[model samples]
Target: MTQTFDPPPPDVVLDPEREASLRTIGVISYALHAVVAIGALLPGVQASIVLLIVAVIVDLVKRDEAVGTWQATHFSWRLRSVLWCGILYVVTIPLWFLFVIPGWIAWCLISIWFLYRIVRGWLAMNDRRPMPR
Candidate 1:
């Protein structure tokens, strides 16, 4: 019997240049997130908010181009991570006024969560896999 093979679907195939560009963008974005995450985990190191803002802006502007691609999930994932972390930190602000220890604990937990997300997303990107929705 003769062997038969079928080509992958169009969506599963990506242009080489386009894929390279997307990967480059993903690397830059992940790098920015890692820096901020590292800073949050350290007591004295402070990552600039500007780095995050820049990352967000780059993601927003390039996200549309990544539509219909696996990289799209990464863009959304990073954005959602930032949004959720910001909201959680803001919501916990009252804890600072009421109890300093609780506030510190809450922030530490949030920071750990933020770092986890960054590391997970970065690893997924490096593996060339799509992030879970």
Candidate 2:
């Protein structure tokens, strides 16, 4: 027996409400990532994981609705940024002592990278531009 496959329908072209809601969520996720990056500096708050969890949940839950829209790019960008930063943190955990000041330097660089992605993506979304892959 032979099986046949059909292409998926093209995405819906216009969705003002979806676009607005997506921009709102993108901004929220951007702020959430910032909070996590900064919260690490505070004395008692271990917010990186907590805030990441929150952002991931929000993004994943709404992702289905944005899949075919321009907003989907923002979701992908946000997830990649978070995933990379998390991996960097994991690397810092074990070699933290060996690297010492260099580790501190690396963490600082990673934090800056995280902030850059958030701000850049947020700005692009505000301008109604699609994120670069």
Tell me the lDDT of candidate 1: 0.89
Off by over 4 Å in 1: 1-9
Give one digit per residue, the lDDT tens place, for model 2 in 1-133.
Answer: 5533222247566468767887788888888987887766454765758778899889989878777666788888889988999899888875677868787777778887888888888887787766767
List the lowest-lDDT window of 10 residues for candidate 1. Answer: 1-10
Q: Name the regions of candidate 2 deviating beyond 4 angstroms.
A: 1-11, 41-48
Taking all chains together, each candidate's TM-score versus the true structure is 0.90, 0.81
Writing each residue's lDDT as its tens digit, candidate 1 over 10-107 gives: 76668999999999999999899889988987999999999999999999999988887888888988999999999999999999999999999999
Q: Model 1, 43: alpha-carbon shift in Å?
A: 0.9
| Residue 119, model 1, lDDT | 92
